[model samples]
Target: MTEQEQQTEELRCIGCGSIIQTEDPNGLGYTPKSALEKGKETGELYCQRCFRLRHYNEIAPVSLTDDDFLRLLNQIRDANALIVYVVDVFDFNGSLIPGLHRFVGDNPVLLVGNKEDLLPRSLRRPKLTDWIRQQANIAGLRPIDTVLVSAKKNHQIDHLLDVIEKYRHNRDVYVVGVTNVGKSTLINQIIKQRTGVKELITTSRFPGTTLDKIEIPLDDGHVLVDTPGIIHQEQMAHVLSPKDLKIVAPQKEIKPKTYQLNDGQTLFLGGVARFDYLHGERAGMVAYFDNNLPIHRTKLNNADNFYAKHLGDLLTPPTSDEKNEFPPLERYEFHITEKSDIVFEGLGWITVPAKTTVAAWVPKGVGALVRRAMI
Candidate 1:
């Protein structure tokens, strides 16, 4: 075996279960040389992320490539398990794993939409679940059932457990999701409810926190496996700093801001996304995003110069320091024949009227698309 592989084979992190390596600080299961030596002597080892989380309540972001995640999925395809696929209700598109249906083989899928509490209370639960089910169907997944719950708020978790029990069919359960969809938090909630342990897994706003599979024993000699979150590179979480992520990810229910715009007006969602009314009557557009995120209005004519001049100053979260490194916004034009929401994946959406032509701009790697209005 290669030297690094041999070293890794010798020691695994007690916390996350990744094989230990001291070579690359940013790599999975990385420990400092001194820490490695100490861990070897003591037989008590935690990777840097787990160590930081345990000692300082801090989270350090780590990422694995698409190939690595695909390998994990391939392993799941061979297992006789019930796949519990969790998605963020607010970021349904971003939470989708490409080819997930194919990867799950003949195993049943239970779709769980998390962050339900982030949506306005005016939206009914039945409607939300219906929407989630429809979206999943379109994505080629036929979930046995769809459940919406807010893992952070501890809402509907018990119902979710009961549902899992009904459909799991005495098989092992595998929970899978894209990074930052609150999968870790949901698993932690399950652990707490079952074993009375709190925060057993590291949960963080930063993406890709869980680097290895964590298996929890079930009473029926089965295991509930919490798999590593698959990284979606198109997400805003990949582009922003941890501080900026905190500013962008909504923490509570979003109180949408409505704007009445003429054909020539524009809206800027901080420096992260831009919306222009290229053609349409003066109409109302409602923005659903983090309540703390800044929204600025300006004439369409001045939009370009305004973004160039004030991106870091008036427009923030590519805040002053992040602006230089931030990817340039790429334009997407949409002709809206029906009432639709212009979604900037992982950022938020703006609901616009029917018979309108609009344009959206987001960071180059991020996605911007139009979908039927949710509310």
Candidate 2:
């Protein structure tokens, strides 16, 4: 046996089947890998690629396939309780679980929208709440109510509990959603707010954290249940290495920015989203997305060449051929007035430059629908 493997701490790269070492950044490895290896610690093995992608935003990811994601949802779907379906505000498409409504049965589903801080500053709360309700309807989930909260920033978490208390009313509460939707983060925030920062019983991070259902005592003798996260198909998380996911998932409040684009100018939101106003003059195109997503501007004429040369280097997460494996890109066009929120299905949104016409495109299977301007 090799000295490294013999040390009892070896990490395998699930993505490329490479033996991870601590020294390489581009290769499959991380600093933590070696430490764990020497101690023979069997930590969750993610190569440097996945590590950086998960923490930074250098790479784009491939989402999980439908069948695989459904398999993960089996337990929650069969759970005997109320379901709180949490989805990321940035990548609603990546967070959606199809046929979830059918599996809900008599238990009412609560749509918990996480990462509200990633939206543009100008977005009005009432408008956003209304839009969220419509989007949930489109997904065929009649959520008893839609609550927006940022688990990272601890926004509206208390209100979320109040809503839960009122609606759930003395029954089991199952928090469910696809991976990377901040389900774990949301749970942590709720626990911390309801309890305190120093609460000893909370599992703060990682996916499938509550590997099974975890029940916590409630005020009236009911219970708050935490369920394992199910991987949702089409999320960039599956496509990206852990390193790349952190880059795209916003870690803080997003600042909305404005852009001046002429007709046929294309803007790429990393590799995840592309916006082109097919036929318009240089008006304004404002973007409301994760602050981590780097915005690049170029003419539509050179958009293809730019992407070809810069796929992973620039236009990321949709990484090389990530979207091509899926169906064609779905096209959506919208007219602008004073202000608007352009929902890019799972990816997030770009606030439009009012009075400017624009068209946005995303992978086919992933829905790219927009509601009334939420700003």
Candidate 3:
């Protein structure tokens, strides 16, 4: 093969920057032979998987194996780089990378909470930042600074860039987060603001769009690196179909729904979750979740039978194809001594008043958390 011909064969995907290949349908960067031929002529192309995800909202599972992700994380251990940890404000707990402390390796991290526009405007910024810091501290992450922004809406992007520049010390900045947390979207905005290039990296509502690291050069000789998102087993994005994800993932600012309930009443967040008011007076239990997601009410005593009979039908969001994949729900009972939120991880939370008793249930692997209310 001639040298020029060999170089042409090594072109990368314009979408996610993975080395373009025609082999292994389930592997990263798999484009079809016909697509590659067409790309060669046009000089612009996306892998088949990315094309489907972007256009059709159809996800083709590609393994970002734990070992491979850990190896990529190891690259930052000794490097003089600043870590830009992005997270979805809506799914803050699920977006957290488990064992992040082991990977950060003494480097200062700037925690940038993305999707701030999805939050209610009445929710104070200082309160949210404080809650984030407390949660990070509990998780053993000591971030030097925290900034909130909505990448899609470009809210606070300038302030975020300024914060990044202040902390980076002219070193390479590594942008990292769990899959579906809007990491790619945030990086794309930064690129556009810095270089006026829209979507320098491929992004979509689906997880795992980026398969490898993509570097963006800065005018000051430093670079910003976009790392592939790590998949957390506990995230609901793993269990739901792409179509159903849109039903649960909040598209706009959340408006809390308050339900007046007495003891022995229950509320179901579709078929995916259940909340039982085990012991409480007739008081308001406010629920925060995607506005479009359906909520059903039933007697606590009949909740079990109700779920069993109507799981995929009336209580929906399993959407037929995803119903069979649903794992048995696990229950977590809590007695609220103070104003606390019963967090359903990838889903939203329920804010119960002090002195209320509630039991929350979610898919087995997707656990729930009880935290002091942020609002």
By the TM-score metric, which is better: model 1 or model 3? 3
What's the lDDT for candidate 3? 0.85
Please identify model 3 stretches exceeding 4 Å from their true place.
1-10, 37-43, 320-322
| TM-score of predicted structure 2 | 0.67
How would you order the candidates by TM-score, starting with the best? 3, 1, 2
Better of 1 and 2 by TM-score: 1
The digit string of per-residue lDDT tens for model 1 on 107-219 reads 99999999999999999999989988988888899999999999999999999999999999899999999999999999989999999988778787777777778789999
> What are the lDDT figures for the candidates, one per model?
0.90, 0.65, 0.85
Instruction: Determine which window of 10 residues in candidate 3 has minimal summed lDDT.
Output: 1-10
What TM-score do all the candidates reach, one by one? 0.93, 0.67, 0.94
Which RMSD values do the candidates have, in order? 2.6, 8.1, 2.2
Whole-structure CA lDDT of model 1: 0.90
How far out, in Å, is residue 196 in model 3?
Answer: 2.2
Candidate 3 lDDT tens digits, 84-153: 9998888888899888877888889999888988888999989998888888888888899999999999
Which sections of candidate 2 miss by over 4 Å?
A: 1-80, 193-210, 219-221, 312-346, 351-371
Steric collisions counted per model = 0, 34, 0
lDDT of 2 by residue, 65-180 (tens): 44544564565556667788998776775677778876667788889988888776677877877887887787787888889998878788889988988887677787778766
Residue 70 displacement (Å), model 1: 0.8
